[model samples]
Target: MIRILAFVLTLGMLAACSAPPSSTGDEVQRLASEIRSLGPDIDPVEAERAARIAYSYSAQLAQEYEITDPPLVHNAKVNKGLRPRGLCWHWAEDIERRLDQEGFETLEMHRAIANADNPFRIDHSTAIISRKGETMRDGIVLDPWRYGGVLYWSPLTEDTKYEWVPRDAVLEKRRLDQHGALLPYVSG
Candidate 1:
């Protein structure tokens, strides 16, 4: 009974993923507007270009990654070596790398991690865009992995589902945790 229910749900998800994704013009515009709103100094042209590249490149990645399932399902496939790449960090890294090519003087790209301190949930990574001289907290989250390549973007403070922290901080903490774990406990 459990196996049959799982099969039905998988079929439904597969059917949902079969449809070709639509153009991202409206999404691009909305993202551009949000990017521009990051600060008064943000360049409108750069914002638009970044938004366009983010959405288009994400779609390209979706195809390259052969994303035929939801985010978690695709993650499982990637973990199982059934897919080459589609992980959250892959999305963040690829998007950040692609965006870096533009050399936007008024914009900065940041990487963040969430759920690093939570034992129950997996760590989530994403790229963020902010005005020059600002931190990730003042940036907008550009998350393409949330919906399995469908870009899910929002302002940093407004993204309620995840409490993001700087990527470096999380990595450093993880390193410390591992080092501590490796040390033998001394019962004094």
Candidate 2:
């Protein structure tokens, strides 16, 4: 009986995720305000456009991967490397590349490293953005990998959920260029 119920619930979620992306960019001013609320001095217009771009990319990826099914759990253990949508890094990397291409004049996006620091635990990856030249700690975490295709965001400094270490863009770029190379300075 429990399995049957879970199956039904999963089917419902699958239906929901197949629906079109929620944001049509029709409410640009409203989205801008929402972005501003997350951080001071952010150009809501740019943020909104960037956000919409990310959302579109995520939605397309989710559809391609058939993750529109949503999932029984948002937990990492369950969501592990499921492919196309697997791994938080995939989402972060994909979105980061897209945003990077668009170019945020006032915003600086950084590869945020979660301070897992434990050998037993793996480091979680995500991307963040801030006013150019502003401290990365005070940036906005754009975690689009979690919660299915839903984007999760929070203040990097006040979140307290994860201690983050940033990599020098130059070295980090070199590290990523290696492809399958270890992330420098990450303890995990």
TM-score of each model, in listed order: 0.85, 0.61
Could you tell me the TM-score of candidate 1?
Answer: 0.85
Deviating ranges (above 4 Å) for candidate 2: 1-31, 37-42, 68-82, 167-188
Show where candidate 1 strays beyond 4 Å. 1-25, 183-188
Encode model 1's per-residue lDDT on 1-188: one tens digit a residue.
99978966875675466343465558899999999998898899999999999999999999999998887778878998999999999999999999999999999999999998899788999999999999999999999898888888889999998999999999998899999999998899
The lDDT of model 1 is 0.91
CA lDDT, every model vs. true structure:
0.91, 0.64
For this target, which candidate reaches the highest TM-score against the unseen true structure?
A: 1
Candidate 2 per-residue lDDT, tens place, 8-121, comes to 686677546634335555543443555566566677778888767756777776665556444333333345655445466677787788888877777778877664455744
